[model samples]
Target: MIGTLDKAKLKERYDICIVGSGPSGMTLAAELAYSGLKIAMIESGSFKRSSLAEELKEVQSEKLPIKANSRERVVGGASSTWGGLSALLDPADLAHWPLSFDELLPYLKAAAKYHFPSLETFQNPSGTGWKFKNLADKLFVAVRPPFNFTSLVNIFNRKGVDLYTEATVAKLVSQNGRIKKVLCRSVDGQGFEVSAEIFILACGGIENSRLLLVSGLGNEYDQVGRYFMNHPKGYAGRLHLSKPLPVNNYYLPRVVGGRMVYAGLRLEEELQKEKGLLNACVQFEPDLGIFQKYAFAIWRRMPGFSTKVLTIFLPRTLRARWFADMEPRAENRVILSDKLDRFGSPLPKVVYDLSERDKATLEELFSQLRSGVERLELGKLTGTAADVLKVVKDDASHHLGGTRMGLSPQESVVNTECRVHSSENLYVVGGSVFPSAGCASPTMTMVALSIRLAEHVKSKLASKPRRTFKNQTSRTSSQKILIIGAGNRVRGDVLPVLESLPGFEITGIFARHASSLFGAHRSYDVRTMESLSVENLKGARFLYVSVPRETLAQVLSDLPGASSLEVIIDTPVLPAVKKYAHKFKRIHVAEDSVFLPWLDGLKGREVKEIECSQSVFRYHGMALVKAFGPINYGYRLGNKLYLKAGNTKVKIIEPRDYASGKLKIDGQEPDLTAIIAELIPEERGLLGEIKSTDTIVSKMGELKRVGLRRLLLAASRGEETWSLEEGLNDVRIDWLLHKVWIYLSI
Candidate 1:
């Protein structure tokens, strides 16, 4: 079960212990969840970012300006914030790697299935329509809406994997050429030990090296953190087209088959090999003038404006941006710093820069790009080789090569299976194990390798009998709740609340898009929802419906077959679902806005005159005012509202006009948090009145009565008092506000 270190009971030992909760670690865990092995997944950060996680990220950089957003320590790791544009590594880039491209192809397809919406995204469109001799299309597909692994944390625990967040691994204890255990500390500074038969370090590029260097585990010849590399990228020059070329459209990121696909221009593989140049991809941004810029912005804002009409007046010139792979150099490495973090582990001192060959490659690639443009009679590039060299300096934040994998111990930290050469049980994954940084983004490749590692791990441990363990109970013995959708709303808001709250358990998840769940929610019994089964509905006490409004009727139509199940509809009840609504014994419309913490001061206050602007009347504003006190008269029409109750004049302001949870009432403003706070106990009691005999709902009502007391007691004892459901509800409101904006704009 997934829990904070201070909460979940620790097992004495586990079959496998993975350090880190990024795409790599989560992928590996999801793949191995059905292996019947007791696993402990330790994450340095919680589901949310904390001060301790931020403090632990400090490092000494030589040439690279390591931005704060470069890496994330949260549960989902970098995937939490990444744009999700990725591609498989080229065969040439993996020339020196122990694993061949052919060997990795299967895992690559598997990884694509897990991360990408469809495999056709990998079958990139041929750019024969946009003819060019020297340049070929370098396709990069973005995981639209960017999938986060946070939703899978609970799923992992449910599958017998104990996931501990906010547990930072401090040091690895080794004996007889194998890792014995990992000494870890909670964010609250409590120390604990996790001993496992196999230990995998998936802590990204820099931290993986730093951990190895400080622990003295895998650096046999001081090669643990060497060969550090990042993709060097920046603007090369400007290309002035004779006329608008169709090839320019390929340069921009566009939606293709429900995915963001960017067909960047790159030097042909044959040409790159002939010139001995590094792999590079170039993007083109139209260089619009001042007036053109405003016109373009306005055109984007107005949906009815035709892009063809706007494009006629735009500039023919475009800024050429280039990203090139760097050669892995020993001089550009991660070494231990003299200073230590709060945990007493030495900080990482990163010394990295481009070599002379790297600079030459950029210059050559730019020259080739100019030649190709000239050959195609498309454009004229205005820049010298020196200009390209001078501007190609920014880091693409694709960290790679440190703790690189190879067959030799003297040359690398890990072997072909990513096992540490110095220790059999210890292994390293993620971008850190890459022997070379490919031109493409590293996330997809990292996931593929993680899946491959899981395969190897499973094969090695298959013959070993399952280890007996105590406290085999899952995270919670609460009421089972079956989720109906796995869309943005469910994943971003609903799942977090259910996972964090005390009296809920996610029994199963149903969604049409279960194919992409290979990364996180795979541990659950995920299936495409065609029709609700009576057997499945009987297992869950409550069915949470979180689909789009348009499809609400079709989804709820199947729900009437399972009459015993209580339904909680997060979406607004449309006219179509009203027929099926009466069929249910107990139905609850979860009006989340009424429980907004900002209105707590007005909880018992009598309301008189209520005026809502056209913007705020549709969502939360009306419900919020109604929740405050009795409203004698009110009329709402097309976003405008007027109401009378007592004497106070209350006006509901548009959400965008103020900060989060801020409301303007009688010229006074108030801010708030925890939308779930006020809703609880009252909401719980209401449910309890219906099902007093039901043990699960009764226990939840009991918990609600003492939630504040338990929160205070936990705080006094230096325990975690994070109001996660409150925060997630706030996020849900934000998502709703976003939808409102889209609606108004359209």
Candidate 2:
């Protein structure tokens, strides 16, 4: 379909000219192309020659990522090489933006349809789980949250949008505050020039801003390249699950027809308070053995001169990368150089920088992570012990706001609607309009805004005197799936249902479609309830739900008239006591479990030694605290403490209790999770001290150092009680190691 020719051919004017073929650009094109808008899309890469090698290179002839992110500079843009995970920008991610979250929710659903196509994905993830079901034994700690984004770009093609790969935009030819024409060309020096009533910028967060700076537009505020963002992802390091796998390590697929297939455990928040900053996300990959076998097979099928067996080596190590986000400082920006590319456009010059704030966030996130690893008993102290943390070689590349949108011209490059402040009709679209860097990925939000902008543009077009009909949003979906549990407008449960309902062949998005009265969070009146009935529970292949509720009697009384269906839920509450407990065909949950994937240090346990006079374990005999009625004594241990939940032998001690033998095993209780919570007190706690299975198997030195440092920092900084028990001991790294090694070796 790429028939246009002539390197310098100039078409006076047309409809729209969209640059870049990534999700933002492609989705925008889809919204406008079918309108019979004479669209001219310019891409820098050719569709026929797209390859993984070329896409991963990080630079094109030394040009950095078209602007900085790892956006695919191919025909389909980043979407061409994306992993296809499509989570909407969480409300938390958009919290700092000028627009209200409610404004974007509806659009997000529409965008979800294009990004995540599987009907199973459209329902609750707990319902349509992993592609492969049998490998779950080894991957014991995977929890796919409610909005685990997946790829579904094929849906865009079906909607009749035009695509141009390997082409690039050279410049925008504007007049009278409007984009009258676009100057574009291919990497091979071929050129194109066209015009449209509306122009969109969806190249990506990084590139969109670069394009603006390169085109020399909207520079009054010097904001064209500021506010750069990306979802900084980090990891807690290698996780070793409690269960045995077929091999040492392997990847598991989600259960057949289930929403949650992949699981990941984050450092509990309580621990993060102690750690400095590290917003981390770790992903598992196909196993090394499986990869090796696949490679050998590929070699057997297409052997090379080198035997090609070594290429089978795959990475199973859990990687930690820093999404401890970076803000776009004016100094950290994309500038234009005097040199132009073969296409006659000035190449973009980018300077990437990390502010102290950026580093601190990561430092804290990782700090808690270190403590967490100890508690989970996942891996040995290898990756994290080092000073500098290593990020995943491969990570989520969805770009975000570069030409950020803001309330005033001084703070942002684009106005609230993505329009260049002073220039009417000269609008910028895509992730580049975000005000703050989000912790979540940005594609779904890009699509959401695109649809909204498209409608605005359509309405503007329809308003013309000659226009015959107005384009209405089409919500007529054809697929159907069953929904369940905790969602809807009432009781403030709107988000989960809203995110899952819009796209599926939705038979209904409810707890039990057979009867909404039972377990219905949005039933306005309780007086209109019905008796619980299992007869209407048939025909559902998938189900979506929220955190499990303890009160089921109310639901049982108002049961609907449908049969059972597959189900997905947002919480980890297991199903033991239930009317349909035996019907656990393939249940899915949102968060990671505590036991499996054993990376959480507390997953197992570690013991620590303290100088406190009150003995934690003199011979594992006397109750230390009870024996010494009152003494100024306390020792530190990891969260995976030797004591069981509520084990009486364990005693907790604080500085205030220096004279009393009293110590709270937990802040006031016990439990592996609880201890970890008290030690780190972060998003997910890291430090865990414990009484052990054998003679105090301890990582003593590490504990003393972390504990000391934590205590000092907390006390000197602002801890209420000047005691060592409340935190990590931050001593010289080597010193900490020496102490632990000496004790353990002895």
Candidate 3:
């Protein structure tokens, strides 16, 4: 099922755990559907692009110009933002690979079928067969609509896999030279472990190396994070033809089988082999007028309104855009930077540069392409070889070759099967495993490798007897609960906490506005209800209410009085519980502060005194009073209130507004994630003082709020909980605080 890792409890183990949900990971998972091997696909990013994901992927690029958004950190990886340019690697690109072109052709065809608009769209056009004057056609195909792999959400259910988004794998734990488990943490800082029989790293080219370096794995012979590559792309030169010789044949996009096909020119593979040159491809685009160029730029930034404007405008000249593959150099690599991300993992430092041969290849390809156009009497090219040499270089967003696959450990990180050479049950996929990159888009080739890996794994598993796994039906079965609100509190906290636990199915949601109802349609399935009907609430034993005061009153008054019904209302709406207590069988006012990690240390302990200083006296004082009770006397000195309890001293310091961005830790600007990490040691210290698990301390406030799980479990068993009397007493303390405040002001 598709659920976020922060809110979903993953199974303890799986047959395989893939660490990325990119094109490669998604393809591999889909290919293994119905294989009877349970899978867990963990994605560091959420379904959308998030700031945390962006920050986590921060890279220190030394030479290659890698933009901040060059590599997408989302469910579909870079495919989410890509233009859907699809093509296969040239056969010469596989020269350094352990496997040959013929062996990989089937998977390539399968990938093309899966990604292309149609199978026929991938076939080359007839006649000279795209070969003329020692130049061949490099096909570029674009689907009618881009193929975003995240649309494969249903595969989770069909494949019996659990897709966990917003979960970042921290380290791979190895035992006896094999990966044993992975320690993962949600972006919100909830840490957990996932163990599996096999582990695959498909977290992109740079990330594959960074993870290996961080985990101290697969670096034998110091080849784990070396030989990084990206297609160096730029406008090499401008070609001014003698005549406008059918520019449509080169510049215009051809509509073929529901796809836009562009035939780019490249050096013949045989010629490249003969000259010992790198793979290079160049496509021609007609230069636009000043107004048209400006319009195009604006349209690119704001795509909704520029298409018609561009169609009305026309171009003036044609130019050559070059994309050349870089030679894999041992010095070009991704290493762990000393700088840490919010998760405390080292950032990837990329030391990448194009080789002299790389530049010469581009120059040579441009010269040959210009020579052919002139030989064909198309036009006399204007831009010279000097212009080609000065081509402004930028990364093509095609990150490849770190942890490259090959035949030996000394030269590669993975073998022909994409398995790590030194470690069994560990495999690598994606462009990271490409021993050589062609001057084509890498996504299609990566998909092929992923499919190949799936077949290899399937054969490896076929020989071994299948192991029986424990059924998880009992944990996720049909105990129903209906949510009564669709506000931030309900969507952000209530639904996630309740959904994380077992034995509860959210049946439906109730909201006044259609927008609110639409907002509640999260990863899981939940029908939106018009009103609280008998049919909607048929099996629901509990109702979670977190609306405003008026809405709570209306909802509580309208509730059906079944003895099985229980109400868990927010603490602010305690008066609603008092008014409607008799209508429901049980009521629990959720005061999450009582379950906070700091407060958990005070539970069941005698407090001698309490020192409180803060605004929001009702909320703050109630938390302290509820946790440590039976105050004999209270004294106010200055701004602080001192309370006498039994013997233990309780100090509630002036709470800092962490969200206001004013708090600082160790002279550094306040970052919520960093502050949370810093507080873990102190939270652990608090746990040491109390009888509590460290897991709760690890999640800090999130799990503390999730302590609502206990109340729900108690309600399920018809056990005792914070009763109406105690809830009223808690409110009375707030009432007393109000009276005291009025008196003091007067």
Candidate 4:
């Protein structure tokens, strides 16, 4: 009764309560704000100028990332301060999205019309080739996503949109599983209630999940607050052209139907298949520093830097990075945190880690891109693949998941219409409804879906007077079961797998560097034999071992505890490891041999080999813990490698990149003093026990008695099933042989 009549002043109830004032939310609000059906649009942040002024204040104070880049609170949500990179999601992502492209085509076009009246002005891109006779101009630059729809919400708000700024929803009022009202709070500590026939959760991905978790309706799938994903994006390698290109790569057009100006890259599906890594989609990013410098340079040379010629001439000579989209599996996800926010609502604690397959896919993707540019006459490539290293995995405060929409209630959180299955009148309108964060940006696609949803809702609102259509006492949108997974790809195989996921939780990717003979060193090798732990397989539902055939068991014997399924994508040897086939989900038949010769070269290369332990990486004397949560698990400390050469005779080192430590031997360090453990002592690690107990068993007599090598291997396996007794039976065999036969043969 309190929630029902809380709107004492208003006798009439609204048809919808639209949350958020960002691109998607604003369009929905603008479309129905003046439809005369009674609508209550809410905004978490106020649009007042005071907030906008505060933005530049941080420009000099560390120049933190933008709101869309990091911060979330401000007027108009993130849209108020976006770069206007309204790049429509790639066709591949749209095709793979939960909602169909055909279904969203009209709505997308409508959204463009509704929000962007001046949209045609920036339709096409035009620019001229750059002349790089100078050192700065010689760098090769490419295209990236754009920022055009900047003042978007303001455009709609000026058109009679009922505005409610600084309004935060505390809880959703429910009656018989349907939302009856929204409990809202003002910045001034005042409270209000909005009664609506429909409710849309448009508070961005993170906030949307926060609302769900806060409202106490998220315990069902364990999938609710899981699979929090992001592109794990970063500025990677560049195309340092031998000669500069025609135009600058960062020019965004100001006016219509411009050539869809974007630098492009392709996923090498052929190679990725051998690794069991799914290729979602791939993209290219232009150098921002180059863009900034060039623009400023023009402004300095010619004070009036706003000339059309300047725009046309500077986009060519710059560096670019290519991005590959990854697969959507159950392991990558969002989970809830016990931490509360200013509003007392729990903040969404995101736990997203990547799998070995994701890293392998990324490594393969970059190699293909590099090879395409160098050998295939694509372009002149610059920088070692290692130069393109950094990855930002903890974001998507832009993308999120958990409440995935699938064909069945058992698999998804919502139905086809972006409605939660367990609740009524509630529809997720922001990127939160997106099951997967494909390689592309999600705004355009989400906006298109909201528009379609709005019309569907409008049609169903005939009111009590027109009870014929309502004769059945139809349940709310929350009760409707939507067919989420049925969709078609506009560009199917040509696009990456990430492009194919929609309304599904594909989370972004797990990234790592690929080992190269003339390039960068590797992190781990699963060939001959490899050891790892269960905890190390965190956030993983899929495992693809790319090692030598003979060593398949050496690597996979301990992996069963990490994931229910294991796939052997490629191996160095064959037939030997093939015998253990019955234990794995599938085996990738190797028709190509890029990995074979590479295995032969492992003897000379320094790579980290890993195993499992209770502690992953130690920092400040604290051990990183791991356990299964909503959707994914955490990473464990697997054994890493350390070189025993040069002055560094026995200094411990991390295996993959072979990053040396401060404890270098350099003559001062003792020989044979280095030791690497995959697990913590007491938890199965041989070195762990030594390190923890202050007991160093270095004598040969002690080694024989304790079965040191085998015991260490078992610790690396990190699963009780392997029994601390026999984890390294395979590893010790190689030791007996003194040198491996296959190692010499290759």
lDDT of each: 0.67, 0.43, 0.68, 0.42
- Across residues 305-368, which tens digit of lDDT does each residue of candidate 4 receive? 3334535443333454434354556665554556555556655555555555555656656666
Candidate 3 Cα misplacement greater than 4 A, ranges: 6-8, 117-120, 126-132, 245-248, 291-316, 463-746
TM-score for each prediction?
Answer: 0.73, 0.50, 0.61, 0.51
The weakest ten consecutive residues by lDDT in model 2 span 722-731
Worst 10 residues of 3 by lDDT: 657-666
Alpha-carbon runs more than 4 Å astray in model 4? 1-12, 49-71, 90-96, 114-161, 247-260, 268-317, 322-326, 376-380, 392-397, 463-746
- Counting clashing residue pairs in each candidate, in order, gives 1, 118, 6, 73
RMSD of 3: 13.8
- What's the CA RMSD for each of the models? 9.7, 27.8, 13.8, 28.9
Q: What C-alpha lDDT does candidate 2 achieve relative to the native structure?
A: 0.43
Residue range with the least summed lDDT across 10 consecutive positions in model 4:
620-629
**Candidate maximizing TM-score:** 1
